[model samples]
Target: MKYQFDKDFLWGVATASYQIEGAYDQDGRIPSIWDTFSKTPGNTYMGHNGDEACDHYNKFKEDIALLKKLGIKAYRFSISWPRIFKDGKYKLNEKGLKFYKDLVEELKKNDIKPIATLYHWDLPQILQDEGGWSNPEIIKYFVHYASVMFNALGDDVEQWITFNETSVFLYLGYLYGIHAPGIKNLDLTLKAIHNVHLAHGETVKLFKNSNYKNQIGITLNLSPNYPYSVEEKDIIAAKTNDAFWNRMFLDPILKGSYPEEILNNPFGNTLKEIIKDDDMEIISHPIDFLGINYYSRSVIKHDENETFKYKSIPQDGEKTSMGWEVYPDGLRVLLNYIKENYGNIPLYITENGAAYEDKLENGKIHDIDRINYLKRHFISAKKAIDEGVNLKGYYVWSFMDNYEWAEGYVKRFGLTYIDYETKQRILKDSAKWYSQVIKNNFIEE
Candidate 1:
């Protein structure tokens, strides 16, 4: 097919620790912020928690078998920070480390490259009690945690992600209080954002300087911002929204400085104090690649009453089960934007998939909508690559349906259907189609 990817272009699937690894209390593993947040009344959908998730911790072999069946080249999974630090004291949890070593070994045996992520929003509850990401003191602890993982799994896991979706966790956790360690304080949110960026930089430096011969990077959930109207005010609103949503996080890492427009903006002014001498230098350490999670674009309009002065307007188009717009071309726009602004840095669509109201029929799922979503997005990615963007690979958002934070088990984003009750995973029609894509290394249109 004309939509073929390069031979080296990796195809993979991703899953987070809290979402899939259900052995929450096993092997001396302690509670993560998710465990605490999900347990609280009215925190998650129908109060559903990830107490048993997909039981991947216990069924990884089965899951990996399914992954092998899909003919993917790599598997991107995160380490449960709490699992390794069980006591929150930075003490080595050999048992916890062993689990990941085993997981990596299994992936390797199956000829799948293991892309390990250090943190996926599953901070130990004990750390949250000690101010979590908001407190600068947590940086040392995070670095120590990274050091341990590097020493333990560096040999087996060649690709490492320092953090996943920093904007989502920081915004939802600190500003909106909709996530773990939830607190609705603007000051705390700014502090958490700065600290997390600092933590990522420090960790990247550690990994790059080490003798592992592996690659390290961070994953960001990014979207292209568009104006709701041709009016200058609306255009300015889109720019402001872009500054807040995209540049605030991107500039610090790629350019070694926060975007000037955002730094002067009212919502971002408070970050100036949180930023310290040489902090930006540390936050902008060079990395091997950039992981981008693109799902939708934001159409913004000026709203003087809003805190950020830009409000998101709902678009008239097809939307996924998660209420996110299905704008595949946004992937091309976002990738090209990165290339144009950030230079030709290597990039990966680390997490991109649509959630749909999937149902099981006759022991199978017919998720044509999800298939279409993925196909269009893949085509967009191919277009960007053909246009000279250094787009490297694509990993579907999830391997199977798990505990979707806040929304809980309601939304299904998996190529494989997970029967939450029986824990039986049946390959959806989309999975069958994706298997062929991976097998052919192309989108067969």
Candidate 2:
């Protein structure tokens, strides 16, 4: 069976600035929250830092050649905020600006569209020092940053995403103390969530008000929640999980309102008090598309003694290298749910790939598991499209292996394997499979 997509359907790969672009302090680049967080003792796994990630900062041409070799139509990369504003102010860094400009030009030379992300969890440390996303002033600063990028690359870059996975950043960084600026406080996390939504809304408005001819949207790590049982308690628990994880951002952005169920949780009333008039209007900025990064799903069951009063039950199924359950049907369900609730907004699978223990042998990596993982999800995505989901693109989570955040370099989620010691990129079997998929523009089973 072969599934064909629209001729213009985008096929791409994604990587973040800090994850791939090493040269942490080079060319007037300042420290970001990741830098501070990783440097602090006991923050990151194995004390891993992005000091010399993939050296993409210096070898961007080589990376572009790789993308061209893959026959990719688009490449989604992020711009570092601290690189643009060294002091976390409106002051532009010419060297940092020129680096990305050169990269974008190189992509254009290869006929690859540059899908630029404004932020990808690399907030300037200066902003962090000033309360970061918890501060309302950060909204203005972010808008200014967005304006600078829009004006700089607006002519060439046609696809723009304001931020990547605010929920992950807020919940992990603040609530779980796992990522940057590690703080374990729910109130601060909630505050950060509010401010990030505000910033995203403001940035979207800024892009719309600009003279750029492009599509603007935001990317979210969306996972659909399923009930563990048909029992009433389990069903209600699933609903609550949906309100917390999915609807928290989707409802505000798509429906112009936060989920009433969220406000009725233990902290619900307090959250309502924190929400001000017109905030929802700001968050409800019209977007050209919604980027969905789906990997797996969670089954929820009622738990009276659990921290959130509901527990996520792991299905008895195969798991990924990251310990995430492998459930491809969840992607179809999520896309269908979004289509039904979000009014048929154009959507893109911005990041959907699995991590597997990749082993390099004889200068080649045979990651059949990754190939199978992607194949299953691609089929699921195709099913969603066939069922009338407006999915416009599908980008693998990573093009090459680089830093894996708190887990450091342990988890490999890339089609190309990287030698951390030598910074060498070796195309794995999955890369070849993915390239073939791009060449055909459809996967055949």
Compared with the true structure, all predictions reach lDDT values of 0.91, 0.89
lDDT of 1 at 174: 90
lDDT (Cα, 0-100) at 398 in candidate 2? 92
| Residue range 242-277, candidate 2, lDDT tens digits | 888888988888888879887767776656767889
Compared with the true structure, what per-residue lDDT tens digits does model 1 show for residues 176-222?
Answer: 99998778998898889999999999998888788678789999999
* Candidate 2 runs further than 4 Å off: none
- The residue-level lDDT of candidate 1 at 296 comes to 98
TM agreement with the true structure for every prediction: 0.98, 0.98
Among all windows of 10 consecutive residues in model 2, the one with the lowest summed lDDT is: 264-273
